[model samples]
Target: MAYDLAPASVMFADVADVESAEMEIVHWDGGISIVPSGPVITRDADGGELHRLP
Candidate 1:
């Protein structure tokens, strides 16, 4: 018989947002250049930082 392995739990529900870091955005023309780093934070329902992945 085959068994189902479906996930029955919230992966990142209880995970709290500790801090936020910047994700560097790069642009290269002829050489490597660092442009800007965008917001790498997950926001909650009230526009708050939820969980920052990296």
Candidate 2:
């Protein structure tokens, strides 16, 4: 016999939004897993904060 291992659902969003706004993770079976660190904020061409993965 074989078993299936996969998350019930997946989601994504901007780190800033997730931090500044309301965020939720709903899973049917398996639990949710979040990265320890969030996206990094760096200066853009115009010197604005840019959110991106590390």
Candidate 3:
């Protein structure tokens, strides 16, 4: 029998800095996945790219 696998939600915390900030990424089957090619960049409310993650 074939089984359907639903999308999975992954969360990553800044363990290096031990900050309260956390990042969440949702993976949908057959959908586009957000893979960070470079360092994680932070953005502002205006959709601007801030500094990269350490």
**lDDT values, one for every candidate:** 0.32, 0.39, 0.39
Q: Which pairs, if any, clash in model 3?
A: none
Q: Name the candidate that leads on TM-score.
A: 3
* Candidate 3: tens digits of C-alpha lDDT, residues 1-54: 111233562223223332444544444563322234334554434556544554
Alpha carbon lDDT of residue 11, candidate 1? 18
Off by over 4 Å in 3: 1-38
CA error at residue 51 for candidate 3, angstroms = 0.6
Model 2 agreement with the true structure over 1-54: per-residue lDDT tens digits: 112225543333345545554433333354443332545333334555533444
The estimated TM-scores of all candidates read: 0.25, 0.22, 0.26
Clashing pairs in 1: none
- What's the ranking of the predictions by TM-score, best on top? 3, 1, 2
Lowest lDDT 10-residue stretch of candidate 2: 1-10
TM-score of 2: 0.22
Stretches of candidate 2 exceeding 4 Å from the true structure? 1-14, 17-19, 30-54
